[model samples]
Target: MRGNTLSYGTRYLGRIQGIALLVGGAMLVGGCARLRPTADGELLGDDAVVAHARLLQMADTRAMDTLLVRQALAASTPSVRAAAALAIGQVSGRTLNHLARSLLADGDSAVAANAAYSLGLLRDTASVPALTGALGGRQSVAVEAAWALGQIGAPSRAAIEDALSKAALPEPVLASLLLATAKLRPVPVAQLIPFLRHSNAEIRWSAAYPVSRTLAPAGVRAMLDAARDESAPVRALAARALGRSATGDSLAAEALGALDTLARDSSAHVRINAVRSLASYGSAATTAVVALTADRDANVRIATAQILGTVLPPQRSVWISAWNADTAFMYRRSLLVSAVRAGAMLPALSPASADGWASHADWRYRAAAAEAGGSARSSSALLENALPHVGDADGRVRLAAYTAFATYADSSRFAWRNQILVPALNDPDFYVRATVLQALGSRASAAETPGILASYQRALADSLNDARIAAVRYLAAAWKRDSTNFPDSVRAMVQALKPSDDPLVRAEALESSIFSSWIAAPPGRRRLDWYQRKVRSVLLPALAGRPLSATIQTERGAMTVELFSIDAPLTVDNFASLARAGYYRNVQFHRVVPNFVAQDGDPRGDGNGGPGYAIRDELNRRRYGRGAVGMALSGPDTGGSQYFITHSPQPHLDGGYTVFGRILDGFEVLDALVQGDRILQVRIR
Candidate 1:
């Protein structure tokens, strides 16, 4: 999922102020202001500038030096203090929470906001009292503190309620607080109901988001009213809330009627959410759901296909008809996977048809055929359908076949299971090998098979980093299953890789090794001199005055995006450098979820590949709105070449992902993209 470590390089900077800029016939609204320089009129000296850059570099490298952070926090300059507060949060250990909390009352709003954000990042439960007290402070600080409380989750609910009970909160603060409520479990639906009717569209939409997340029956009436709100986002979330809350309740019929109307709403985003909600009514909503399968929007059709099996019976004629009629591979694949998930007999595909698909020239169809085996009625049928393709010429097909076998087949009943699986350890594809290793490790028979053991032994020396990581996981799983019988060689291998050059491999090895006590230790700082130099020489200079923009050329059209270089310089530099090096050329948008995101930058065409190295996340104050570009990560600090652009406002993703850019033009082009769409090239400006 991650990549190997490499020596660092320097980059440059740019900043955006809250202003509207006309770019190529489109209006681009930059919501965030540029990071302020020192208050003094005197230009920052060279040493001072480098020192400031070093603080950011320390955060980038996750250097956990409390003393340095404390010194920076005590700086007279608001910018330095603000940077230190952000760094403390980015480093993300609880060691500096006290010092960070002390900055909550700083004279500068930016300093206080950054401190609250850091406290939230640390997830320090002890800071709740202090954070809650700031909920009524400056509007900006209150918003950040509320978000931080939400990040801390349910423990801060009473404090949030206490603030809400107060006389009058500003619209911005109230809207932020309402959105934060979405993150807490057992959402305060009663408190949220009144806000749904708020005159301000922003507040109404914010209230709708929490109700959508909780789906509490009590909010059904208010949500129903919100469904007709002028704002598409409010209507979209309200539709979801109605479907989830109205199920098996007195409001079911009324809710169903509202969903049907909303399903035809002008906004594709509203329609996508409405279609998903319609699934809750079962057969009662089938006709409406089936009608959407023919919708002109590919994403809407994809959404309809996804839930068709849930709404319609397994024997419905519509499944086969849709599969045959839909020409798009993504839609057809969605239909098959949905049908299989619902345990459909899949009578649509006869033996000859199945065989034809398996032999199809396109590997995607072949992979789908392999995946369809999960729908088989019996073990024999499952094995008969999936086992033959384990050695398919296409690695994706082989990967799909192994995945099906792993999920459905009773490998223990088949005497030749090891024969089929052991050889896959040598599969040229690292992902396939990793999947096979996972499959083998999961089976009880792996411990008794000499070939399987030998395969694990050989995988330790594999060239690919992911395969070696998988081998370490297999060793850990094997050890856990039968520690008494665990081989010394495997244990030794795990120990030997603990200091691996690859950060992921080392992290994995450290996690798997017998030295469990050492796992709690903080991660060692990787302050590579080359990386620091690059941050100072390349990244810092690039951010001077001018803003950076990237034009991504896809078959649909070209979309120009303005980079948030000042807020997320590291991420922007990585993307720009990668673009210049041709890493994204010809790469497919491997993942596209309706009304959510279109993700790309994976070389393997699967969602798993990266640029062969990982980059540190530069999480900033940027919010995810329509056309926002953010990094994709499997977990914290694992971001690499992959990134995605939001199709609509996704409030839940705020503060969770590194958002580095926003679309400046070609919104229509973004809306037109679908799965497997190719990036023709990326031009940096």
Candidate 2:
């Protein structure tokens, strides 16, 4: 991940010679006084300086050019000679091939090591001696030698065999070799088996994933044995390996038993891994996972609950009735998590079980239930168990409760959920407050977004960009929910009225407003269906009638956007009319979900605010989300002037409502409008 090459100017000037020995070789250590700059005497320097500069210029293509080889081999400085050798190997020809072989004798390890890399890159068979020598010289020397040898293919077979034969190869080196070999050959499993008990944790851990992909009967048993090891990391890795392994009659009991022990492992991480792995076992390990859904650790319980949420049949009860029979205090929290994941309302646990979790003082369990049980529909019974517990002393639990509400807020079926969000706005945790804004962003109507909007407006200036970015996502979601163009127009009006400090914010404003709108109102399943959607156009005094300048920037150039008033007559007329009025000006492009498009256009400089009014559903065929420029809406066809661009396919918004036009070029620039990046301004060309 680190930069792979040194900058050329520094690399060239940094290598000055310091002293000359009687043997004609120069010792270049900078501290040597004998070679220090002199005031009076001229050393043999002019010719050498000219030659060095010439060599520096020649270095780029010297490997392919044969004329430089003899001079490069005879160069006074090892560095220059090394540079030339490196280039020599880069080219394909007979004469330069000999020069690459000659570089093995170079004294400088840096030069020789590079030459080894070049040899490997060249895959020249004769460089075997050089690579083998590099293996013993230094670890980097050896490691690169090994990598290159492997890259060299079978040319260095004897050296590779000899290196493998040595029992003393250090674990890191072996690990590197194993990692490298795993890339090259299927024998990585066989080669790594002997090193399983090796003293390196990294080697064992890295080996686990690859081994899981290539399981042998013996390897499976070894991994199973490792699952019971005292080391939690080892146990976790072994569990993952086993989960991916194919189970036959011989391994079935062992596999299930390992999962059982792992689900109950004292380590939280191991338990979480077990929850995921157990799910991979499907129904074979369902009973164990069910028991695990009751694990004492909140993480394990949550993971079990969440995994079962998806893996369990949709609408089929994920919760079983038998979990209520568990009388143990610890068992209740975990069991209820399982029950809730099964889509059942809160299970009828014994009152004693709830009191024990509430009384034990850990407090997170109570919070965990509120957070994890978010999937479980709230009822009078659930509220009886959950509402009083929200008053728990632990601040963490209270925070979880607030965050969980956001997950629940969007469900119309859970209309009573806002009872949770309104109160949580003031919670101490910024995390909880953030989550509330997000939920409200999705579920909040324009009226409902007022409080969250003010909060986001204040927080956007805070140093943390994540809060701002999140606020943008929610605000975008909120605006889309309120389908009227006016909610979005209010945003454009503010931007049009704003002071231009970051012209960048203007780009974001345009992007966010446009993106959220597209997400809100995608094209109808049939293009004609989108035409049926309607919104009342408020005629702006400035816009008697003019074309909208709908160009989005990409790296190559900008693409023009045209709203179709004839096709989606109402949406087109309204947005084009707004564009003609100079409604969009210095707005911030507030939301840019990476690999997704940039969003802008909340008047508050937050993403939540949208024009007031909801429209009917206009389902269309155009896909929404990435690079899409479509109308924003409330519910179905409640489209407004606010529109958006998408960077990827958002099937979720398809067949929702009107899509007018897409960016024809400039997608690269659209990709560049990153979070915290400003929109310069969106104007007619």
Candidate 3:
């Protein structure tokens, strides 16, 4: 019945393309060899390709028409069946699990692989037996089944271990099985130790990844062995696992020694992870970490500065020297904050010295000064000095000032805290307003404060979706704090939002936990019309055989990424369109975590800006290996213009984010990127 209700867009395109191709084929076949149709009566050439594309569009839009997907699953063409199987997973078509499960035994490896991947996405526990059985069938199929079993969580751990125990498995399949084992709770760490020494470096890193997450004391010795691994990636993960398992015992001393050696390793990646791991040893690691303050790599220096701040005593002169020596904004900011945290009396926090940084030409320094003010022992003076920055010309500085005041300032002792804060709710920047709402909501006293409650109430009607979501969060916090004293007007306002036109707002309301009845009700299905229109107008045109590589020109250097147009057509189209429109020009990489990811694409220069809308995730089988480009999200289906590039293999991010592309070159540029690095332009080929 659902298939019978196919949108006009699907039918119109099929008729036009199919007829034109049929006419063309007749002319060609008359002059050459006759073409044939497939066993299912579907044409075997261009027509089938068009049909496959149509199924992908349905998947992209998250169309709720399951009957069409079902029909495609049974199509004679392997490509069409593969597309349909993937679509069922993308759309979360739980009802179509049976059809997808049947495809696990499909003759085509691609079809069976996609079917296993779909079952994983659906988390179909019922299909675990079928998925496990497919583990010995084909290389591609077995890997997907292992990953799917892992995605299914605890139910599949035993099967995963059983498969891992088998001898002579393909390296790729063994790697997938090892990574999948990480997803299970109370990981079988002992079983993974031998793989830490696997001849293939890829398998070794894969084993080390799970060990890093759930490192028990038993794995510490093996990890120490891995810490000396020839591969930097394996060593880096081993360093992390050692840190996690570190205790005040003999093994911890051995780990500390290995970490110390790794701290000076030639690789910056190894040094960064090793330095962070050393921090767990407290005073024992301070000396080794302190020596790396002059490390050649900025990221290493930043890591070293951070550890020293946490481990060093108050009177250590290295804090002041490091803060003064580094001219880099992020490094200097790290040292300054760390100095304050260690209870060191830095001249920078002094009233006269604070003015120098607060009035610095660079807004980054000014923001840093505001952040340092928050970390100081006596926050009142620093808070007072930062009060004027609440109205700074730059939104970042203003955001910092307000965040510091809300988080660090003693509201009871400081009379002007709320006076400066209450006015910011009306700030021009939506991010600032959203931040203020979250700050207000987190306070225990917000429920009794008429002004704060009124602020949440007023924000419910704010123009921005983010602000409204924050207001809903505030209401949820208030209700949880004490519902009997909750305001009825706020309750009514939340109720009104339950049926909001904005999907994000409605989703937020459902997430707020205030409406139990609304939570129990199944979500309504979205129509395929909008998605079909987007497919016809935007997605299809973008995929017209042009190269999909995008070169991101930054001050550091240009990083070329090959977009995964076939797998993530809509997301690629959205990014390419934005790049062409100059949307990402001059955007700064607002967030960067060492050895993790460098995130950018915020026109607002904060992490929150988008292209005024959201797009559904096109999650595929792409693993988040080093240089993998992925769409960042606030929640599901919230991807927009913002994206991030991984610095190393991130198994955790594999299925979560939309991996639309990957860097083909300029890896050094990716490693060198810091928080304030700017994207000069993105040139799409």
Candidate 4:
């Protein structure tokens, strides 16, 4: 962990060193404890102890934990009560809502904070008064209460406005209040302006968020002032807001000056966002683009490359030359691929240049080249060159090749699949096999049926859950495309949804069966119901109260995160189960977007790999701040193993990705992580 993180831990009781000991002690004492209350009426009974122990176990089966949750809620121990309050949200029982509401005034601060957080998840509007009351208190409780009010939405607007009207609140509390209030549909931007000019940078930045979104003409001065603020984060926020303003061109001169200044800011985060904002101004940012390309930060250079590709077409050679001259191909390969893909200059580039990269000594470059081939700008020659890498020795390169070829191999295009994709169906890597199957799914033709069916059958028999999922999806798509040609495919898909131990595989099978059909027949509906029943029965029990902690053993060092089982149980369960199954072992941190995130957990050691099935999104009010751990989904509910830890607070991703956990220790370890760093293992505690 970073030194500052270590010092921060010393002050933050939540990150206390003996957390494991505390948990273990709670469990041990409860094992033999009997039902008895002290004369003081503060002692926990055996039932309460047992309930607390069960809740602490982090059970995956949330729906079945209502009784235990109720018992723990009444427990005398503040920790037990806090844990229960959090659990109430996961269980999602109306009966527990009043209990959570009552805990909003719990004597202990932690219990109160958790209660507010849970009530938000429950969206209990009735708790508005209590939440608002808590907002005038300490930072921890206030942040949670304010966030809860936001989740309560329109109903809590008046209460939030009233809280903001009060004077001299702590910066953390006020900032959170502003953030929470901005999330409400009708943000009180007029009331927020004074705080925008507040001496405190945090409050200023928080005030800027809603103003930027609204882009009210009155807020322009505040935005401009914030752009020149001493704080890098505040400057970053202002710079971002300037780019989003409707009157961007009118404010171009001042905004550009701020952007240029912020682009060279001391903080890498400020510089990154400044460049991204510059890109948003279109060609108007051409002058800034040239300076950004030569930026000291590698990520800035990468983002600059992506921007110049679209806005400065004349810089094509400059971009290509930079790529060729950069000696650190291994480190720069992923960024280069992203840059190339964003630049859309592949078609204009020489086939020889693409070939050289495709055949590079580094597998990452080859993999990247394969990915680049999928882009619309890529030439047929590039695609052809990428095909050879499909059978390349590296599994990651092969996966990328399959992905690229799949993108290029549309149903209208026939020759490439037979030449490259067909052979990949039998590839040793299950992901490669799955990708190939996925590619063939959309091809509409009677001629492709037999081979596709054979491949589908092979995939269904494969041991990997992802492979089975791919097969079921392909079957559904194929059945939809040509019922006459693949008459049994739909029926086969429905049959695959039968009682299964694997929730991921069954979930995918059900989705493909129900949604893939062009017309949902009565039979399909019945099948969907059957599949739903099977899934709920098989998954929920295993999911209940499963305690989850992940020991992310990175190359730098090991860090443990106590997954937030109550708030985001599904995400926690997915991560914990995968860790226990050794899925994340040896996976590399594939993408490290500086000052943004350090992402890993793809088995392919590339961003594209997953367990092949997506779970429901458990989006919550949790902020994506530094050390926050979240599932890295491409879209809603797409998370599966691939997760990221934030380097700094990322407000933009707050409601987008599911924040399931936080780094309990090892901030330095997460800070030190970079692309290509291997996760030695992710031990589930």
Can you give the TM-score per candidate against the true fold? 0.87, 0.38, 0.85, 0.73
Candidates in order have lDDT scores of: 0.71, 0.49, 0.72, 0.63
Q: How many backbone clashes can be found in candidate 1?
A: 9
Per-residue alpha-carbon lDDT of candidate 4 for residues 466-539, written as tens digits (9 for 90 to 100)? 55556666755665676676446535544544343344444454554433332222211122233223223322
TM-score of 1: 0.87
Q: What is the lDDT of residue 549 in candidate 3?
A: 81
Model 2 C-alpha lDDT versus the unseen true structure: 0.49
Q: Write the per-residue lDDT of candidate 3 for residues 239-260, one digit (tens) a residue.
A: 7777834544768778888898
Clashes in candidate 4: how many? Answer: 17
Better of 1 and 2 by lDDT: 1
Minimum summed lDDT over a 10-residue window in model 2 is located at 12-21
RMSD of candidate 2 to the truth, in angstroms, is 24.2
Q: Select the stronger candidate by TM-score from 1 and 3.
A: 1
- lDDT at 303, model 4: 55
The positional error of residue 110 in candidate 4, measured at the CA in angstroms, is: 2.9
What C-alpha lDDT does candidate 3 achieve relative to the native structure? 0.72
Q: Is candidate 2 or candidate 3 better by lDDT?
A: 3
Cα deviation at 435, candidate 1, in Å, is 1.6
